[model samples]
Target: MRVHLFSLSFLAVCSTSVANLLGPVYPAPRDLSSKSSRVAAGWKALTGRLHSETSSGSSLLKNLTFSVGLFSIHDSAAESLQFHYTSSEIQNAPNGTRKVDGDSIYRVASLSKLFTVFAAMRELNSEQWERPLTEVIPAFAEYVKSRANADSVYSTPWDQITPSALAAQISGVARDVLPWDGGDLLLQYAIAILAGLNPVPAAVDPATYGLPPVDLNDALSLSPCLANVSEPCTGPLYAGGAANDAPVYLPWTSPAYSNNGFILLGLALANLTGKSLDEIYKQSIFDPLDMHSSYSAVPGASEFPRSVIAGDFTSGFGYDGGISKSSGGIYSTTNDLAKFGTAILNSTLLPPVTTRRWMKPVSHTADLQYSVGRPWEIYRYKHAESGVVTDLYTKLGDAGNYGSFLVLIPDFDAGFSIIGASALATRSNATSLLADLVTESILPALMEQAASEAKKNFVGKYTSDRLNTSLALDVSPSGNPGLSVTSWVSNGTDLMPLLGILLGNENSRLVPTIVSQGTGQVAFRAYTATQEKSGGLFQRNFDVNDWIVVGSGGYATKSLAEFVFEVDVQGKASRVELPACNVTLHR
Candidate 1:
């Protein structure tokens, strides 16, 4: 009913010739082949600064042993320019120490939550996901029935909670069920006690001392898997532990970080699939992605050589997390994690549509930059030049002596992993530092590389063999970004007019899509701008658009705006075929 005048103006402004319209489709991006080299150099400079800073032993990256991996589904060069830092402090014997690389193993802490949620998606149906925790885990259901007061803030509402809630960390449950998740702090306490710095009186029993107990009726914590010190919590153990625990927030009230939630989720998944969480992770993720260096729990002694082990917290590494393996107990190498991240970008495990649904945010957090997805901690990274916000679906983990980060950029079909360990037991600081440094360095490179590739591959004019039908495509870094279809003519009849567009010219963009129509083709759909007429009274976006919805939809069963590119050996565009027009155009 309405159109954006600027759409027509922008399209027409390209030039007097209709061919100008295509210039936006593949505007030549600045040549950044040397940018990656600069990035590599920048890392050296930054790491040199870090090395100088680390002599203090209190630097952010002090005594950090870490690995980083970057991956892109479409381009192999995205992995280049990675850095590894190994601190001599982490090893007792540095005489024969080997450098950490992509293959160095480290505990991945909460990043395991992503794998747990992924396994659930792979095996559970919608109905199963919606099924209440009581139905999913009979043990929890019985606990709910036994305590008529189970729905209060002092206890969890297991009957109303579902697998989805747990996966999203919205189940109103406590953050951790494992006493050992506190091993780092416990180690500190032990050191304090031995140092004669009495934070507590000598009369308090060591077992009864430290953090206050969380039990509801009695002053002591009720369960919290009190029965199992060495094994995964049994059904009754986990249920009783989570049931008596005080609620952090009301169900669906907000998203809180909860390893306990994922542990319960893992248990529910195990009950539903009739398999352990370990099996699910092994079968659904690690095996499919060929993540050979990843392990659900402590790696075998043979694999220990490849593991980055250090600090007093290292003993906790062998502690069996049991069902908690789904929460924060998995171990993986950057090399294998790169495979995992690239698999998600490539849609190698799930269908493209399903993968799309899985990567999205379920709810926003108090912080504008953060959102919660299916166990994903999403960060909104804003580009300085375009102000375009790139959603980074990420997971960060810190436990015992290890810390890690997994980041996926769906918009760019790229991602990276950071794994770090410290004798000082800084769970995530080192990895987080590495992640920030690498993110700053790599995001622009990815953006530039994508633009460069699009420029080389898709920019340029195309015409039918008859030369009567012509299409011009180009890209622009600002104003109109990405690939745009600037001009189009079919047999000397302007297609813009034939489409009934009274606007000056067609303002359309060729937006990239995750799915391809055929083998060896890159998929893209057309997007056009339109705006609904405003009566000059008050206004609402209900009718306004950048020009909303023009050239955006399909005609009949076929789309009126779709295009696929045939690429060359180096992935440069060879031809673009429009299925809607039933015509193929070549460069």
Candidate 2:
């Protein structure tokens, strides 16, 4: 890896012991005396590793400030830890040192979307979760139609988008439809200003950067709109001619990350609540959580202390953070974020049932390593040494110059939030390194906690002669509450790889973990379904709809397929019915 070491002139005196520099880990009142010592050791080890890794040239983790909060819903006990570090003087900010307590604010880009989504969800009811875009904010849908070519297919499809689908990044909008994901033109200007590079003349004009230049002195007082809109600013990438671009596909055909989706969702939220996005957030989430230091960057109205990007203290236009209204315009501190995350986990912010919906996998990547939730990313994080595969729900934010990550492991009753402010190009990768450390050093500390009973019934060998398939279910005791299954056809062939193309392959094995549709009887449910198809004359050419009978190319209009297992009088599995393949097998 090559380090694009842009010349930076920054100097600061930093000399402190690791223990002194990393402050105390806030523990639950009852366990404070005992838990503090245990948590300190892990914090020290994790920060020490991060500090050492920053010595590398290409590593984006030159400096980091973070907080970790551990809490259990069963017991009201909760704790938090804060750590700050400066790797080397080479990439450090001139005005600010790596020393940050819980209160130091950093610009957290996409992480802002989490707060926006949460606030928006709070204003909606169960039925509104699936409400169409046309109903939520028909005006925005009309705007989308006006920008597209008169005959474009996207104009009509815009009405079909749902708020929940947009939150999950499955709205079928082009990633740059509203182009809130940092415009290239704006980035060019930001890079020049931050890195002291040669100015790209193209970025200085309204036609170039998408929005008019921010008169530095006047930016704080002026409420500038992007184009003709009355909102503070929507980046030029999606403004004017940019909106004319065709969409990737019709709604929900597949998943594609869209900043525009979130932007539109934010507008819909305002329409629903009859309040500005920032106001809706403050009243519902920030104030209730006592996160005093958190604020959404909305033009001149709400500006919090922000770290400098490149060599300059930034505001207005795409300086510190990009000019995104609801997408990535938030500045918050470690302490506040820790509280926010803990509150969500404890159901203090949203009800437990709704919180679970936030983590549920709405859409998954092709490899299945990661799943997209409403505004969260869910995945199994495996610690190498402990070999503990735990489910990690995470939301990552990268504001060009700074990176932020909030991770939660509900099973372990703990989570960590890291905020890094730096000018390194690889700042986005900083969160991954810290997340890995949290999984390795911090999660194991909570090992004494008990596992869910759902695991016991799920681990067994299931086979069906008629269906010609066999399943070996094993207990990943350290993993989330679900059985891990290795599936095979009766011919001893792995059915996983072939299902990849047929089903968009989120994950291979079939694990009927959740119980569904039965009383006084043992039942199970699986997230996906699989069916067989062939390309030969007597067989079909594997129609896209063959495997999963749900979602875009499916036979049904649902997200997950249900599977039910029949158990004998002894509560032992006797046989199973696979819905996707329409087959019955004996255990």
Candidate 3:
């Protein structure tokens, strides 16, 4: 049982156990003594906690089934890990399985939007992004007109809503067209009323609402409002009396998580492509990616399938035969998803340039507390104590009983996915907690691997005895793509007096470009002005073109002052000599 084996708090605790990346020590390999070993040990400790006998009983997370999937690309070496677990009793299980692996299928709610957006992008042009929803669905157009004379509260600018805005989740549509029950019944009436079209009702049980007709054209003929209901379309599905909760802003004015917008976008795709959402995905992506285990609708998936688990509180968890399907109807395994991720990252699915644009930030709030890409999410993970920041392109899915995460970090050339399900009502936060573990553990290790490879040549500590100063070279992949030298008091003893005489206060640190690889000319930008007294008069000193040059065992100062290095047989600098200043720095 993998119950609560990775708790949120425990993940936080395990974060500190990894080797300090900023220090001299390198990240350990995946072997027994490496960082991977620490992760495995952490997992083991948590597993023990999961199975520990408590006054209450066994842990809830240990009582449910779950799975984890990972793939790492560092220095071009690829590695993968996949495992799953289930409770001792089968009936209490969410997916009703004892174990799962990369190939095992599970419902990945909301992640379906990524596929839908991709499918739409392949066929739709830039202009289609802002194309009106009513233009694609004429019935929705009729609904707009019907509400023209009604209160201003229930209407939207039918002409301004676009698939792009909706995909970005900036469209002002309600979060859901209706609550679950209202949504289910609305799909029911939509099928009957849209007479000629085949509509997949929201109801999971076919007996609850028999399969409607298969005429897409006929269904397109239904009015937004039904004649049987004399009142204006209201409640969860329609325009009733104007209320305080009605959307006040138009599309793109703000950000809202609108499933209704996605559903409408799906309809627009069908309308524009003259293909069902199912056919669109099958033809555009699944086939191309070779995701055979993936399904829009699982076969004989009972009201609940062991393969397509739903939350304990969630009502429906099956194919998105209707509107919500485009928003949450995907069922896939980690292996299949990795293939999809590989396609996006490698630009096999779309052109490299276009895919890059797709991942760019599409929506962000003032405080940056909320932000998202076209269909993906942008996340920033900052180490609380060290301030090491990592950027991630990610997507999250939670279908009540099931929760999942798919992440990509281009910086590390690595990505991973986590999918798990639980029938235990107490395990609601399991998925997110596991996501934290992945974030706190896996990512930092991979980043360290990449950094170690990139910095093996020139990163070291250099000390100047005369100046009593120590300089630590940190090579970062950030702006300017170079190294930064930070000055520190040698041996933690304050040496401001020595530093003040040899180097200007402003010259304590240097950020310079790497003019050549293999320890070649490192140039530091030098300041020409000496100092400004209280009079605000700046005294000119060094030449305007002055710059520092670091070379083979020798360096030139801003004033063309030359310093030579004393090197060992390996050509590594052992000491740096500034003849003009009578200073020698030991490395």
Which one wins on lDDT? 1
lDDT of 3 by residue, 1-587 (tens): 11122222221311322111111122212232234444344444443443452112444456555666655422212324554665454334454344466666777777788888989988788777668766766655666677666654666666567788889888776665433324445445555555654454445334465654433244223223343444544222332211112464677786667666677777778778888788988988899989887777653444234353534323544433354567777788888887777677667778767976787778775433235777777665544433343456777776555667778765444577877666556544656665675666665455444344324433577776556666555554422122334443545665445543344433333322212223433233211122212221133212111232222122253231233444332223465444434555677
Poorly placed runs, candidate 1 (over 4 Å): 1-59, 76-81, 93-98, 148-151, 178-220, 227-233, 425-427, 484-487, 493-509, 514-517, 523-564, 568-570, 578-583
Models 1 onward score TM values of: 0.79, 0.60, 0.61
Root-mean-square deviation of each candidate, in angstroms?
Answer: 8.1, 13.5, 11.9
Per-residue alpha-carbon lDDT of candidate 2 for residues 464-516, written as tens digits (9 for 90 to 100) = 66545776555433322234445645446676565554444534223333322
Total residue pair clashes for candidate 2: 1
Compute the lDDT for candidate 2: 0.54
User: Model 2: residues >4 Å from true position, as ranges?
Assistant: 1-41, 54-60, 63-78, 87-98, 138-156, 177-243, 298-310, 315-323, 383-389, 448-587
Cα-based lDDT for every prediction: 0.67, 0.54, 0.54
The number of clashing residue pairs in model 1 is 24
lDDT of 1 by residue, 35-141 (tens): 44433444555556656755666677767877776676755564653667777755563321346777777778778888888889899999999998888877777
True lDDT of residue 180, candidate 1: 35
Winner on TM-score between 1 and 2 is 1
Give lDDT: candidate 2, residue 488: 41
Top TM-score hit: 1
Decreasing lDDT order of the candidates: 1, 2, 3
